[model samples]
Target: MPSAPIKAMIMAAGRGERMRPLTDNTPKPLLKVRGKPLIDWHAEALARGGFTDLVVNTAWLGEQIENHFGQQSQTPPSIAYSREGLDFGGALETAGGIARALPLLGDVFWLLAGDVFVPGFEFTQAAVDRFAAGGKLAHLWLVPNPAHNPKGDFGLGADGLALNLPKDSAEPRFTYSTIGLYRRELFEAMPFGNPQGLKAPLAPLLRAAMDNGRVSAQLYPGPWTDVGTPARLDELNQASTTY
Candidate 1:
């Protein structure tokens, strides 16, 4: 088996503007789908999958996230937080948040969104091992386009590299599931803040890497949901009997 990056980071800073009312006080990731918090699924899976260190970035109501897993430090997969808006205010966005958390995240790590529900997806050792051997800057999971986002984000080349081809470019495009494994160097030497953190999105950096043939991808034909809107949340809950 190839070597794997054991540390992981979950993006929990999104304000969830579309999920307001429910997200007004509770962070989107904390909102219950069936009976469990969305982020909890990731936490349990990461721990069960044998990951030893986990970092979570937060902004709006970040303390709740900290409180929920306050004792994780005393356990396995030791948890760390990259709190935003306490000294700076607002979130650091995805890439910015990841950069700020690099000290905890280390050189290579798994990065996943907290709001996405991928119940069957496992934080498998084989996936991590393959990623470490690929020498790529990033690896992403691409899912079939959901209704809310039909145009999709990137295309998968025969070599497994993500391509930023135009929507009509003829290459099959798919939605970014917001789950990835990344190398730290991808965020370095950029016009961005360091320890203090700054506001920025992740897509531009990813596209740049793809241009250099540094990002690979895989098509995940499994259950997944973005949970962006309240109605979508209801649909999930109504469609499920288990949390």
Candidate 2:
């Protein structure tokens, strides 16, 4: 088995524009997917996979998140927070959020978007081992593009590296599942010390690194859903009850 990451982070700072009303009072990560918080699914899975420490970035009703998980305890991995807007106004976005949390993360850590609902995707030790040995800065899991995002994020090359290409090009593009293993150095260029929040997207950083062949990727065949809107959330809630 490959060595497991010592620390990890879950991106829970989105405003949930499409998940309004439900998110009006609650942060999206705190919203239940099948009787459990979306972030809990990731926390439970990471703990089961031997990850002991977790950092969660929050904004847009972040207090609920900190109050819920901070006041209580989760096993295996003790939980912590990287608040983006206590002094600031809104979220720092993905790259900025991760950069702010860099101090809390280790050299290599696990990262996942808090809102994605992916059932049965395991953080295997073998994948960890493969990444530890590969010397790549990032290891991503790409899934088939969902209807909402027919044009995917990156393409997987024959050499097992991630390639950024236009969806209409000959390369096969897959949607970014928002689950990945990343290195701290990748966010070195992003500012972190400001309380006002460093705002930026994560794609550009990944794309720049891909050009140097520093990112690796693999296709994941599993039940994955990006619960962006209320309609999708209702569908998942209905589907999950059957099982």
Candidate 3:
């Protein structure tokens, strides 16, 4: 049987309070990195990965996001928007946002953060085949912890399951790379319109899946930066130029 087409959702509705001034007028995803809008890199990456349908949720000066890339006919993956009006303020955290966009997200799709900068990482046909065969609810990309987040996010065991790190354990924790493939069923029970983030809903499901050996995680050695603050954004810009 032919594998299901890969779809993608770029989460881009945050006010970017940490990246003030620069985001005062423009949304964080619209912020320039290496002279290009941050989201542009993600859009191009997804298209290159063979994703044809793209859904982006926007708020907080969302008009700019729509104006620039709303109808990007030139891009391989056609882009669409799920506009959350000003009354909604900004992003509905993460899980809530995904829940709100379920109509557009099909069965299994990649969910990526808008501000993170990741280059040259594309989904492989073999990987997609494995994902389809395993019937897994989600597959995540984990990276080594950075200086800003030394504690990291989760633990990857030898069995390829993602386990929550012990609060008192001193072992190195692996950080979530903000790139993941998820099944819509995982978020089926989540309540929408609330600001609950992805963690609240995903953590339990991940833990359950880990116990049952359903979740899969891969180590990503490529360059990945969480461009949340101005300092990190500047660092990414500098790195792009120097390297």
Candidate 4:
């Protein structure tokens, strides 16, 4: 079967509390890595991959994001914003924000965190075709555990299924790269306007899919950094000079 057209969502709504003082005024995504805003790197990657429609959700210091990108420009994807009000404050966690922006995302889309810096991964047309044909709820990019996140997020079997880490497993783990494609069905029961996190709601669904041989993941080997703190930001900035 032919795959549906692709669109992407950049999750940029976090308050970046750990990145405080800096984030006290500028949103994490708006902060510069090297010389460009953090979100610019991902936006350029998406556009290069031929994804045109992009949705970016914002809350803390959102006006900056809107002002910097405006409606759309020639160099980046045509961007749209799903503004989360201050009354709710902070972000709507990953799942809730996706749920709230379903209309913009439609049935399927790619989800990526705004704060992470990666040296671009291989997103082949074959993979996109497989995702569109399989009808799986989500497909994630997994990387070998980095020093900063040793415990890791999900466990992958030889069969390509991604299982939630067992409570007692002591083996090496693979960290989620904060990038993936998601189908709308995964958020059918997720509630909006609350402090719900993505893990609690999506883990079970991912686990069940893994057990049933549905969920899939691709092991990515490349430079990946989560610039959540000042230290990591500095590290990525230094690393960016060479890349």
Candidate 5:
């Protein structure tokens, strides 16, 4: 018999402060790019890759999201929601939201932000298999630093490990694509990730892991856009249909 499909989590709880008026009522994940809800692109891609069990953590007008995907076809991934806004009274940040959704996920799972536009990304089982075999706590996909973030978030070492470089370091760095495969130990082994609700950011945990060489990463030379601003959204819509 075939193995069970891998589980994936799409982080959709961000308030989209940058998008402002557009996100005033609708959540960032529901914003459209190429005439489709940003999160749908991710869901379709993941489903095509055999990741049919999906968990979405939502806040900031999250009810719309729940209603939007209500009774979606089985061809798309099945969604189990982590209603952060209702349960925590607000968004729980990244790490905290993941922790809240931990009960719905598996030992190893795929993670990505719902607002990013990477239409070309393929969430393949081969990639999951490779990550599972690597024994690393997390495997991240890094992209060339975008125009808005020239400084970048993390450095990629020659050994395929993520580097926690100093801010003043003059090394080449890349922005995290918000796409990754994570081992449960990365969150559970830490003090956080409890289902009881602990609000925290994810960068510190990743940085600490990078320091210990437990995080691996690779450069993704695909089309990607962090659709954070209205201008960026407009740009994507006006640009290529190829994306």
Candidate 6:
């Protein structure tokens, strides 16, 4: 028998406060990047890797997102929505949203923020296989520190473990690419409060896991942009021809 399709979650629930007026009218993930919605790029990559079971958590004008994707059951890569706005009145941050959607996602799933732009990144079955063979709770893709985040987020050891370094530590740190393979246990053990509408950030959970040496990471030396502000979006559009 054929194996089950790998499950993945595309996080689209952010309010995009930095994006401002643009986000006031359009969801960040729906904003055009090279003439296509940002989330579509991730969906296409996951489809290529056979991660057809997808769950998208939405808030902040979520109806637009739902309308764009539609509620189709028989589609090749089936799409499901965890409407946090409708259920909870707002976004559930990152870890909370994932916990809310845990029923749909299985033991392991690919997790990525929908706002970042990484056009050439490929979601490969080989990556899923490698993560499955390991005992780590999460495998994150880290990128060189961007000018906006010079302090970076986490340190990566030569052994592939993610390090939760001290704030003043001079060790090299990298920005989380927000692309990763996750085991459900990372979220399951957390106290997410009431399930009806848990609100929490993902950093604390990731840092705790990192402290325990339960996370792994690798550097991604490729074109990537967080696309947080209007200026960044404009730059991407102006340079669209290069991509």
Q: What lDDT would each prediction earn against the true structure?
A: 0.85, 0.84, 0.77, 0.77, 0.89, 0.88
Instruction: Say which candidate scores most in TM-score.
Output: 5
Deviation in Å, model 6, residue 185 alpha carbon:
0.5
Weakest ten-residue segment in model 6 by summed lDDT: 69-78
What local lDDT does model 2 show for residue 173?
92
Off by over 4 Å in 4: 1-4, 71-76, 191-212
TM-score for candidate 5: 0.94
Off by more than 4 A, model 3:
71-76, 191-212, 240-243
* Candidate 1 residue-wise lDDT, 1-243, digit = tens: 446548889899889999999999999999987788999888888877878578888889989988887745556357788777675688888888888778777677999999999887888788887887778999999999999988899999998899988888777799999888899989995543366566678899999999999999999998899999999899999994453
What lDDT tens digits, residue by residue, belong to model 5 across residues 140-211?
999999999988999999999999987778998899999999988878753544556678899999999999
- Per-residue lDDT for 131-222 in model 3, tens only? 76777788899998888888887778787777666756776568888898888877767754334333233466666766666678889998
RMSD of each candidate relative to the true structure: 2.2, 2.1, 2.9, 3.0, 1.8, 2.3
Candidate 1 residue-pair clash tally? 1
Mark the regions of model 6 whose C-alpha exceeds 4 Å error after superposition: 1-3, 71-76, 191-194
**Per-candidate count of clashing residue pairs (backbone under 3 Å):** 1, 0, 0, 0, 0, 0
Candidate 2 accuracy as lDDT:
0.84
Ranking by lDDT: 5, 6, 1, 2, 3, 4
- How well does candidate 1 match the true structure, expressed as C-alpha RMSD? 2.2
lDDT of 6 by residue, 137-166 (tens): 999999998889998999999999999987
Model 4, residue 148: distance off in Å is 2.3
